[model samples]
Target: MHTELDFAFRRDGETVRSGGLVYATVSAEGRAAIALPARLVEMLGEVRSIRPSR
Candidate 1:
């Protein structure tokens, strides 16, 4: 899966962005595997569950 690069300037005028491509591949044992940037992994840790409001 791929996500479009999205970013915005913070109040402090610093840009914050998060977007990356997810790759699908087979593992050494013939199992499905995924890989991504370490920075993206770190960002994932900060993710929170959210509900869409109408």
Candidate 2:
């Protein structure tokens, strides 16, 4: 299922800001974490594709 997730920006391992994302998957379960803004979750209906930004 797809859902908006909240998170915070982090300079180190600790979370300094709140930011995350709930991406939709084809499989029932998977191992991976997607980071995104909660406000933009709705904009992404389904996780069509993912690529490394850097």
Candidate 3:
């Protein structure tokens, strides 16, 4: 059996953003940066009620 894992960063018991950041292409360079809403990041272990997709 094989599973594709989606990994996240967990440090001292919290989920920290750990990924490559893509820099925005400036409008001067003919593009604009997107604004994203801030969100809370936390890692509270695994969910026992979850199942694999069929």
Candidate 4:
């Protein structure tokens, strides 16, 4: 399963929003958090999600 993260950048009364994706895997121990590359812009209001997709 994966979780979707969203983020936004605002500057000079302008806003640009983007999304980041994270992944999870179930193993014998428990759910493991997977690390992925996320794309982020300047003036981040909140860290929702920031990842590049192929």
TM-score of each: 0.22, 0.24, 0.23, 0.33
Tens-place lDDT per residue, model 2, 1-45, is 455444456686775566466555443355654444556665655
- lDDT tens digits, residue span 1-54, model 4: 444556657788676665454444454567664433243222333544344554
Model 4 poorest ten-residue lDDT run: 36-45
What is the RMSD, in Å, between candidate 3 and the native fold over all Cα? 14.5
* Candidate No. with top TM-score: 4
- Best-matching candidate per lDDT: 2
Q: Whole-model Cα lDDT per candidate?
A: 0.44, 0.52, 0.37, 0.48
Which of 1 and 4 is ahead in lDDT? 4
lDDT, candidate 3, 1-54, per-residue tens: 112224457799886754332222233454554432122112323423222454
Instruction: Show where candidate 3 strays beyond 4 Å.
Output: 1-4, 18-54
Model 2 TM-score?
0.24
* Candidates arranged by lDDT, highest first: 2, 4, 1, 3
lDDT for 44 in candidate 1 is 50
Rank order (by TM-score, best first): 4, 2, 3, 1
Clash count, one per candidate: 0, 6, 0, 8
